[model samples]
Target: MKKLFLGFCLLVGFTTIAQTVADPPFMQDTADKYFFEEAAENVDLLQIASDRNKAIKVLSSHGLLLPHEKIIRQDVQYRPLLDMKLVALTEYQGQFVYLTNKAVLSNAWAGKLYINHNIKTPKAMGIGPDFLTMIAGENDFAIFKNNQEVWRSSINNLNPISVQHDLNSGQFLILTATGLYQVDSDLKTVKKVFEATNLTAFGFYGDTIVLGTTNGIQILDRNTFTITKMDQKLPWTEITSVKNIRGSLWFGSTKGAFKLRDDGKYDYYASKRWLVDDQVVDLAEGPDGSVLVLTQKGMSKIDFSPMTLAQKADYFQEIQRLRHIRYGFTSDLAMKTPGDISTGYFHDTDNDGLWTSMYLAGELFRYAVTKSEDAKENAYEAFEAMERLTALPGLKGFPARSFERDGYEVGLHANGFSEEWREKYEKENGRIWQLSNDELWRWKSTTSSDESCGHFFVYALFAELAPDKAWRDRAIHQIKIEMDHIMDNDWHLVDWNGKPTAWGKWNPDYVNGFPINVGDRRLNSTLILSFLQTAYHFTKDKKYKKAAENLIKKHGYDENANRPASVIGFVEGEDLSNTWNHSDDEMYFLTIPSFVNYSFSEEQKEAHFNAVKSHWEVERSEKNPLWNYLFALSGGKNIDSEESAWWLREFPMDLIDWKIDNEHRKDLTKIAPNFRNQTYTEVLPGDERTLHLHNGAYRNNGGSDGNREYAPYIYLLPYWAGRYVDAISAPQPE
Candidate 1:
């Protein structure tokens, strides 16, 4: 039976990996589950009518019934009660009563009649704790006791929209278009407490009355009767309903629903993952603290429960399973369609090699820490993909951006072609075409320096930790060929036309021409030093060491390396530092581990360590787990393990690059946008930030989607690296 169940789960794309282990610390224990029921069509109202757990009663245009947790439909046995088309239900005098268009039904399930209150119009109704039922129409309201009218009052030009019996205060509050009225316990005298021209909804938060108006929400103090507008604190100005669930205040609007916490912070839930429709009409709380939201389309429930770290790990592992599948032999594909894992289409990014290398590094660390054979196999496979990159191209040791079959033509066109040459190529494919001599495969050309940085960084790791001797030898050979190619071309990556690629230039003419204050000089110097050190360590080649020594002696590369960390952010005149180059940041941080790990001497190690520390100090505000984890590996202090965990939690489960707009959010503190496009939020990678290929950590406005979607390596690299460096502990199995 167990085997059959496992087979059934696999057939439906369920992961069988044991995820729940001994409880992990810093676990996010809550998740929102959604339910869409066609039977409850146009679900406009929801309420917890019973004290029993999960007995969530919902009212829709079609019927009224108790909604089951697992089933999408309410039970069919309650169809008789639903056929009455009851507008509202309430507990009155120890019996469940429901109101229809013409009369109030008592013992609703058994079709017993209560009071035939032949009301022409029913605007709102509520039952007080004293067994007094108040039913209101357009301009008047009646109070009833045991099916007999006790008193009635004329609202006088005011439209009674809703009536609430405050259980805590033991008072009846009536909401109308003109003003809010509070009735005395004796049900005789009524006083107008607050006045609003366009009052739509009202709820009680403790003793304070929250009124929803056309502009925003107004909080009226019961004692002082002072009104405070909450327009500036809400995400939207138009309010639909204001509900107080326990102590927390939930505001529903045309945009979505948001909860104002006791701490004055806000949690917004509006995406398709959380809502059936963005327009929220009403909200109700279940007996077990589950929130049921009523929308125009359907109902959604958000259940808060504790989630262990093992569960989160399993989720990320499932992401890897569905998205990061092998394409060729060892080439792991980062899918372009992020949310749609079944698309089977991968992005042709310029930094495919670099991205894959980061994943390889992550898997290698995973293998070292867990001794998992799966991790080892994944690492070895990615190593083969990286190896193929160097040999697949026309130029020896020149790694291609990516390689594909002849028919699979996608991504950026080749650069540095004459107009006439481009015109001729346009006749065939409209882009620079580089087909293999055999016409079977084609590799993207015009590779940049970033690719080389990724190559040397991962190759160094393979040399140090690869279990197979053949793997280490292949890594070493690739390092020599690539480094030799760079040196032979005078420290520049020569292209098909024998000219240095736009971004691969690192000769004295380009590196020394920049001012001492410029970041390019410092960035290039650091990269070249790291590359040369990596090449020399693996091949034991003196020429690579000599090249490094010459750069330090003749080009002031050592002084450039020692440049203060202030060169990181923005410089007044230096264009390079004025704007944050996220690609450069990735290259610098990835290179640091291998550079410091395989330094030529103690002096070199100390110099690189200082550089790494200084760089990390400048980037400390980013709260990037990957940067913090890498810095910890370089022996830096205060690695921010807690903040690393926070970052992973902040990363949304939906990896798709959906356009998110938070500019109109009133809760956010706005700062003057700068060259780096920094946001007001201190947390790294704000929600509005773009999830780009290399610059996923940078600030971005929410409306535009990038061509490439990031791989799981963005999360896996830091997670495993944290474990490898003892910054985070792995969860023990049950």
Candidate 2:
């Protein structure tokens, strides 16, 4: 009877090991459509305008700076001048005109400088058809026609601020601090057209004239000559400049620039996301339907390039390949100068394993859909880097947070690490830096559940999908060791100290210790279940299946695993639990696939499907592609495809970490802060907000001063995943 029992145990609990990766049955509409992509480059700018050929030209302190190409860029081609201190510029009759302190000159039309040296203290200048010029000074203005002074007029001591050509009226308009004036094209009559206080700027919008004031904007009808005040909220009240580009009114204020959308809502372009500085000095129409904004320090071009989602994915993929690779791991760029890609360098991050796993998963998806050899090579390289993390520690199934060469560990005085902090860290986490087995490298410790979740999810996908048998076996071997270590060590990642790592604990005492309201309790339960399911799916081991069943039936883990995300917020008296943990969301969504994909029974799968849906419903407003695609894969219908595509299409082409602040914008409806940290009624579009991965997309305001360039994996992962699952389609020809 004892031999029979032992044989039963061996048959059911023991197993042979072997090995192994989107949401959705919906196909993305493959119609060729275009979306505007935004990026920024720094150039010294005093004024900007497109030349006759539609080439971008900037007036700087030195002279004119022309775009190296038709598009704006950092290394603008310089046109040096030693003749005058240029303060203003205009484009007219295929001639580039410039304004000095007391003279107006053009770029040697017919080999002769069209100079008006009589104009004194030039404050502003404007040019019309045939080089008809009006130069406004402190108290007077002069008009020149065909390089000849035609008329001079006194401004009534109001201090002229701007001179502009009214194309619709064929007249020149002069703006002073107090009012607007008009001059006939024949240079015969001058009339005071309007009177307003604190007039700052103006732009012609169709048949109406839009005027900018210190408080708000005023519009005047050209036919009726009646003025109406605009009451809509602006990004900032004090408009510095305004221009009409492509029939839309774009206003520049002290805070930033915003465009009036067709829906009446303003698309705010502020912070370093769209400009070098928020203090805008001028606005002009740029080449190829772009808008050039001149600020206190530099010029920024807001471009509108026609691109498809697939094209954008290729764009981000190129960025990922060109700059983000580090030791086979996808890495972000650290820059010495803000927004300068040339000054960028790659560095180690706390979530190297997690980030690389995400990128590797993306490449695998790309290969699955397109069968690109490049994508396969990318996946293979990332897999090796991750495998090295597990091998470096020499601890079965444990992965390092990151690694560096032997001499790269920061000293006590370096990188803000103090002796006191190091001592405390040693006590709690047992020395973050551990010499690898080879002694040629150092691996970071305190390997949290974040890394493990990424590891199991990606390794399993590799085992299942890798084309080569040896690579698939290697991936399966890694998964078996990791799952075995967790199960053998009481469902915890026992670090080198023989104690469970701080965030890797899944024991009932550790997970259920918290009240049902805490997210850790729910998340820990979900994580362990998914891990076991994945282990069993690949290894076909009864022990993994048994361990999972025991947790669910005996420990109430099933109840905890299905808890809605709404219930997992703000546990009072728990410091770390006082707010929603974004990192936890990343770990949860990343690992939830296994729970849904490898359910033990139909009933369990149904419950998991509902759990994924419930969570996705709560996050619906975020329009995050990663979460959306994950839910679609979990058997969810009615997933938001348009909004998900919008999220992907609007992601900024510039991956630089530029400081973006939205708390001060008046266009947003402020809401009382909640446990989820949602501080506004609506989430900002991707280009309008800070660059965030799936985790921080829900955050209202965040960014650093152009220091780090995030790896493009944040966009690549969802894009390629969507492509693989047929939720998104390949690029169609234009």
Candidate 3:
């Protein structure tokens, strides 16, 4: 027995220390980037300015600014300027100058407009602090002072693309297809500073010139005109534009737009969430520190400002609205092509009750914390769905996996059944039901242990925390019926065939037969103990306590309580324990609250607490907000509050389950896959990893073609749990 305990410890130690380095700590002040996109196409230019405490977007032909609004109609009143085909728009000495083919019109808020016709049909233009304008044409360029051409020069074999002025040094630069030329402030000398092939765009960053070429981005020394560094890590090779805003460099490519951080990494923003189109034409800084990206399908404003807790709450509120409206409370089905459809209707999942139970649990927490009527209503609705599952199959206590209208016969397999199986599933035996109502409800059969765990877990919460007596009584009734059914059937969930389901067995013979080192024995022991404790707590049944104590004393289940936590990764010669089963992990964690909160005695509570702490210690490295929050609620210390907040803030507001692939990202540090198929990285998976079930947000590589929207409860559960336990402060009412 001592050797068995030591072996379990060694197994857990190996899994815990598999990663060489810990993930970077999350800071509270980290700014979150928000995306806003419009659908109008042919947006050639973008400009930003502060107007009346708002960041107004000035397009080549129109201007408006409203951050919260998703769409802006064409007829709404824009800037005071007349609608015209303008060549360029720029800021000169705190005034906006709109350039046309024949003239330059400068406007100020004081209702002043100055038109200058000195330069003819300029291809590109720039304005200096001295109120001088530099204009460049196809083969000619000139410097203008006070609306008059002061110096003129002719160019050969160069088609000028743009003109720019350095605000710090007051030097002007002319960017052409083949080379870059610098013009003296005195307008006397024009020198060819750098030569590069297929030059597309250029920007000044301190003493270096960042050049965007067809191949990659090149950094050149301003004085020596020599290439210093080449960055080929962009998602796409074809560069379109580059802009230096406040200290970070924003790169626009044919595929997407990304910001180069000070640490020399990229935060990519693409897809419909960030842009209507991937082709970024230009970029400009808004007055409120937002980035305006000009693309083939109009403008997108990206705001990267730090959000206060209240602001985060508000954002979550909006997310709740969208979630309910588009992908309302339902089981998330598996999809062959995610994001291609409106919702996960491709195929139903076997864990529908389990998923809905989790969402129901989240709403219960929300109601407990905020006392919000809407949350209570949602919880009740979800509870009704759960309650209906057991009654639909016409079994006294059996809960089906899910239910759907009749004629939705995609998942049923009638031909493969044997004579014995058909006897159980026959219409006369009550295995399936055809409701007499207009909607013929047919329930899925052969429910698994995963669903049972979710049902009992939430049933306990509902019985204890429900606001009304009816809900509490209903929860108690469900618990009694399920527990009675399990107890009478020799501690196993019998399917419609009167045979034990594969994973729902917890009989003593089956559980005690497995090797002590295997996870199933330990998992079954923990779950049965939890169920017995919960059943006794609400039903006041001594038989449940008697059953629990017999397992602990006779079968040594107490010693096995921590054994599951000690073997989270692979074990030699044990196929079931060779990989991390996130489904099992969910079940394990979900059982802890009941196990500890309603234990049989002080000793039993202590045992459960130790098991929770041990599990949390092994899981801390994952930085899962749900795990950390649950641990805090279970009285574990060293909870990662800041990391929890980071998870909530970084969760993509767009919950469309879009296809995300980041395997080619050079900025990430990848470790070899562990036994659980998890690749460790320096940052949280939620930020870079592919979306997967029971996985942290840090997974990096996977793609989906169909839309699999998750319930907002994924976020709400942790958020409200953090609030309930005081791990996070509640936001002030708006």
Candidate 4:
């Protein structure tokens, strides 16, 4: 069952990231990979000079540091001066380790095994010539040639022995496309275990191998070759790579990452970013056995030290006390800090910590649900956190923007690090968009430029609970800024930034990153329409009604690229990323039909709907991995029974949660004619296919180019699909 859910993995391969590819139109991939590059530079520096912890500190060369979590930080210090930039870095004990495929071998290591001499598939002198097979062990090693094998050197004189594969865990987990055979240490003959039918990753916990596919996490008992499964309903799940730091059993999927716990259920922390490109590269115990991070993001220590278990436990206890956790919104995460960049963030762009702190607290809040005593305590903890968080700090000009209670950054629109970026943008060529360049930047400021859509959710919770006029006014004002994008005299939704050159107008780099850019009208328009619709529902804000009507009236169905549905969004660039384009159309599907049906705009609605009905083929086209009913929901609601049912039943139904669509980009249909095969998209490799590879994260623009932004519809849809979920019960405006 789990294996069946992994059917979509290979079908989502995206653009070239590390290798050579065609040139981009203009805006270069300015994303700073310095941390990765730096780590790679120190490859082969993994000499065991003494304590494993100290070696790790030395190897890090300051590229990473340790934090305290469940795993305690090792007390160690070392010199620094890393040469090669890192692609992958991990600290085990005191020794710092790095990976560089192009490395010259101060000593060589491939996969995880260190080689005395470079491994060689020595050429055969005769037909089917016998080759040397070297096996690794704790101290000793063995070599096998032909059918004959011998053990030599070090501890136990032990060699890797073949063991039966656990079907639950699946056989043959593919790492680097190389098949890894599982075996037990206490064995003699090399026997063939269950050859994996087709899978990517597996988690080995003592005798149990956990397979993580879209369906759920399946536990395979190696001895019995039996499969037991545990599935949590969600969009995705993942199993982490091995971490030898604390002899731990760690894994992560749609549910989250976990460390081996005595209680059997692993201690967990879940986040889309914590996993790899939708794959868990490593479930590593860092310098400190604190929070185990299941990702490839290069950093020695993930600083979760401040979050103590007692504090978290108390937090959990409080969360369990409440039924629903309502939160207020602020613009703290959206800021660019003050004084540096050229682009202006509409909100709290600097203190990213403000949002994440709440997000983390939210995690604890969620965990409290299972324990009732914890529930009582968790509610109080969350409330305290929320009130304490109300006063956002770090605003530059507005004193009112400063949350007085906590002294954190606060504001509604056009503020934060982006403002700082706007101040220094031309000079720097681009902006970090977040705050403070410190390596452990979890509590800092940031965004993907396309971040405005979710801005109100945070604040709306606040409005729902407290109903402050100030919060209401601020939310309303920020939304109006989106309407300002339309032409005053004509009212057509022109390119918001008004870039003239084909590329400049759309600014792929500016609009398609991650959180999303406000400069995007199709997106902002959809959200704006929805916001107004929502506001009118709550406040009867006629202003929103007026704006939605005028905006829809001025743009009409045929104004964009000739097709009404295609007109859902406009790009000033020569081309659009898969993520951006697909999500753009979602806005139309989500709002236009409902808006028309409800507001007595039948004639125009039918016309626009007809445009959409005509272009429906293009919107659902499979040539790009970016279109679907999901986008429709992002803009409005995914109330379709078929789509909803499919989502619920097949929603990450297994431990190995991979959307394995075997068809190549050209072979798949179900999408649109212009789309089924997107040779038309001229985007960088990493830029176009990023969304498809996320571990249950937002598919912002689909790829780095922003094609899969429609991905969020998968989660956001049920909220507005008129379903009977508790948080919001409003139906589409009529």
Candidate 5:
């Protein structure tokens, strides 16, 4: 019986496929789940080092030191330094030792105590096989074994900079401002191996010594001692620290931290996406094969956990349920304290119904595929919230943009726009606030085409796929009233003042008013045609089809709808046609499902298919799963499922709106600004940038500060819809 039920679920998941394509292969395996956490308190970080157990030890100014352990969370263990000003930090034999102004100290099980070191005024410390090496003064270096100084020597007065032990050669390597030196295990003589100026850091890669200078990298062969200067191909020069972790060379520079990949390319980690600040001071191997980056503000741990796409979805689902739901609708979370999730509150937006519909539609798809009762409840709750919008305004078919309880100041007057702009706006569109019939709420007016697109799309899905009869009838009735409103009012969503809303126009005079280059001309035609067809498909009414036919034949909408995105260039002196309208893209994609699915004939369906294909061809570089999955519904073979999976896998688990700036990176290839506002030739991974909304251009750089946390509707919709259409598989067995 269990196997039979599983087979039925798979059948329902694949029921919406017009044609089957190979699912994304990466969905069958574990992918990287990336997230970051900051230190509890900000401090001026000085040095960071890791032990064999991967516990990180951090030293700060004024004798502040903390040991960090990674278990369920990045836990900071505060151990007192006994008021001794620590100068450097390193771990030896699973114990953290510190070089202080008074003496060398060890943080063992007892407490902070002296290490009985004979060296005076230690400047730096390094770890060896059985001994601890320290730079004693400007020209002296000392070696200690069993907490006692064994050997002390004066170099050729080169002015020591730092010290480290070479594990491959079993020698204590010394770095000076002018040259590099090494001492054997006997601690007899220190010999200068290579000469270099402005040396900042050094590490070992196999049998060669890799030196980091302010200008570039220098390599020296241990056998021959021949120096080779390599060209600098880093994001920024001025290397501050270097480490060889798990056979990979990681570098810390003035601008950011990056790793030298085996492919000879550097994996750059910059901006707030990966660190608290761009100025990375130190780097260390962290727990679970992560990296601990120390900056002026604090420490940031970048962790990569193995997870599947379904696991990522489930994680985001919990986040949304915790902070994004408000009044039974998906809402944005505004943080009272910037970047602090604990001080967040859900706020309403103008597209509340629209966003809720999207989330609700995804839940409907999830319920169809998995038959989960939780998903059904989520869809029903969101539907009720959206349904309340239509009835709140006291107008049968007119839906409010959003609603808030009484006594809240909102709308145009409260938005702080200039008086001249507000006056002009009022002249074009009427007053945008109305009191609910119950006198206990206020509803926002001037509903746009975006809301209508969301309404019809989700209502049609529920009408066709809902498991319960009563729910399906409710969905059908809602679609009828909304379509009747547009048709009865001559293709305009009439507002409370008996006038059409600003963006709710679909009449011939309105859609045909703009030039062919304007996006609204094509977008409005597609929307109304889709709306009429969807109404006819479900209601079986002859008038809706007749209205659609009249618009297509008499209004030249077919030619307009088929226009390519290539022709959407800037038109001189036309405000609406000056640039690409991304909002139009969102509305078009949402309406395409109904436009293609409920077509009057196969010929019309083919036209819709061509329309989607053209749009997808331009947006293929975005690698958006939602667009790809929607295109596959029209039987598109080249849906770019791999790119879609890339989008899903690269999405960061942290949804906070961190200010990400990639413009200053030298690794990016910049392009001339075009009509689409595409500044770069290639899009950065989702983790490297901000969370992009469907209406946002992915090619754009820079984003808002951490003041808002977006919901998971943007991700949930595409993921679940792809599962329903066979573009993506369920989580595979590990």
Candidate 6:
């Protein structure tokens, strides 16, 4: 019996070892990189206090967690001395380094520092910037800022405050422009560590420090204040930088990057074969320990990972970085797949709203940076997919909004049209609605037609920003076709091809159709004014002027008698029976001033601008996050100071448990799990709650309205809020 028990235990041990050695999907040598994002959050912080050690062992093998006192909803909430200006200010060990000027800090001794406004009470010890700006130790932070000897610390913030914290409790070799110094609790005060004439930069692994100076490389020991030289030919140029990786010293020069192993040998690791000027701007370690090299030309990758990690980055880089790779998209600049379109690659996330937003913003980011390879590559791929969309014909002169996964036209309002699909579409469910001839040019019931489409404006914005003039021409040509060809003397824009059926209409506050008796004011606004204003933003065309001017003059901006000094309603006309209002009233309020500012006619400009501001003052609640985002985008005078953080407050405190909400309907409260693939009623709303985080859009297990990534608002809100203005241009997507 004892032997039998021993045999069982032996089998268990073997199984555990086997799991540890389980082969990854790809080989190690060819691996490029792997993402370790949110790795810490995936750890079970909800584990029992008794099992804290087990929790630590299981959590955070990669990426980083920004050192929090407690965990909320499995996400770390680090209480810092400064208020968290951004959601992601971090602490490595115990020594906290503020990413934003005002960041949250916490200590076992002091509680928390709250941020009332932009002003901070205790001026950050290192208010400006840090050279070796990484959080290295548990309670220790290393900043090579002023003098080589002036590193700062927060040893007082720790719980036990031991001299032996794995990361924080370590020696700091400060590198100032003047000289170097070392501060230690072991010593009475900060003492002179070493002296170097023109020390450039340095990185610390532990007590050992590698310093870059005008004289070359000097290695210093913390306990003894002794300096030694290991490599006589250290790569130290005017542009050289230092880092310690994999327990060995490394350096980056204007020409290339090199590494030193424990076996007393240095090798040239990173260099550009396709070089222009060969000047390295920055070098940092990526998620999977790949050598990240930033050069004057663009970012480059090094393929050397551990055999267990990836000896060659070819496979790993391809597998891990989904951001750079396209799926089901054959057309690529590098190489074309058999079924790829003529333009280029297809999609990283297909054509979902989330993917569209990311692609749009990312494209803007690329253009803002001006010709970075990452930006170019991403834009190239997006343009290709969008271009293919143009190939799909329009219904009643407007392109269909979306397609089925099979690449067939499934537009509810796109049966007969000025443009037709490449492949013929047959009515499968008999749910297809065909438009009537009377609706043509009248802008009524757009079961499918593109007279005054708001979404067309979004499409227009992207089309205008496209690098290809041909693509831009096509987008503009479409607008011309609608404005010149379809817009008849009656002044209505829609030519409804779909048959009038008893389908429910949508409003900002109501999801499904309320009652047939209630009227719709939004559809007209979305179709008419949205398109004109968007065209103005894009082409600055005088042709769009005719349609927008007519609407403003006739409707009183809402359907009242005369053009009033004050705008009555944004969405002017609709059947009161449908009970629909244009939720996008904000679009008019935002774009009016912009249009006015751009206009040569001063009277028209002020009239529009003044009307927008006056209406906004009355309409905007100033409290809702969505309106706050729009208010900021409007670039108005007498703005609210706290409006910026108001947007941040809604940034989904727990990204994991992100609740999908429609807010428009109570019936479709939450989507159900196991829902995917089936689009346009093919998949039930109950099916949308699958744990899918494709790109950043996610809907998991019985959700409604496909919140966030699954929703359309997340990307638009941030873009409108001017979040990327610091990184790119403001007021509009490029």
* Candidate numbers sorted by lDDT from highest down: 2, 5, 1, 3, 6, 4
The number of clashing residue pairs in model 4 is 155
Task: Score every model by TM-score.
Answer: 0.83, 0.87, 0.77, 0.33, 0.88, 0.37
lDDT tens digits by residue: candidate 2, 597-622 = 67887688779768777777877888
Worst 10 residues of 5 by lDDT: 1-10
Question: Global CA lDDT of candidate 1, please?
Answer: 0.67
Better of 5 and 6 by TM-score: 5
Model 6, 275-315: lDDT tens digits are 11235544545334445444443334444432211111122
Candidates' C-alpha lDDT? 0.67, 0.75, 0.66, 0.31, 0.74, 0.35
| Most accurate candidate by lDDT | 2
Ten contiguous residues with the weakest lDDT in model 4: 1-10
lDDT string, candidate 5, 361-387, tens digits: 889888978989999999999988888
Task: Give the poorly placed runs of model 2, Cα more than 4 Å off.
Answer: 1-45, 53-57, 60-81, 84-87, 100-105, 108-121, 142-152, 184-189, 336-339, 410-422, 427-429
- Candidate 6 residues lying further than 4 Å off, grouped into runs, are 1-47, 50-362, 369-373, 376-380, 383-390, 394-396, 405-456, 463-471, 482-527, 533-543, 552-582, 585-600, 614-633, 638-642, 653-734
RMSD of each: 8.0, 7.7, 7.8, 18.0, 4.8, 25.0
* Model 4: per-residue Cα lDDT over 388-474, one tens digit each: 321221221011111222223243223323555455642443222223223221121122222222333323323332224564455
Comparing candidate 3 with candidate 5, which one achieves the higher lDDT? Answer: 5
List ranges where model 4 is wrong by over 4 Å. Answer: 1-598, 601-734
TM-score preference between candidates 1 and 3, better one:
1
Per residue, candidate 1 scores C-alpha lDDT tens digits across 1-734 of 11111111232222211111123644242334335546443355443243333455555545565545533455465555756757665544435566676666655445644655545576667777645677777667677767677777766664677788877666678898778887654647778887778887888887788888767788888666688545656777577778877678988877777888666777776644456566787777655666777666656676664454445656666677566644422223444563334554654656678888888888877777777888888888888888888777658787877777887856545433466754765574434436767788777766788889889888877776677788889988989888888899998987655667667877889988887767678778888888898787667789999999998899888778767656655656666667767667788888776566556676777787788888888777777878887676555657777777667665655555545555666767777877556676654333334454445455544533322234566777777776666666567543
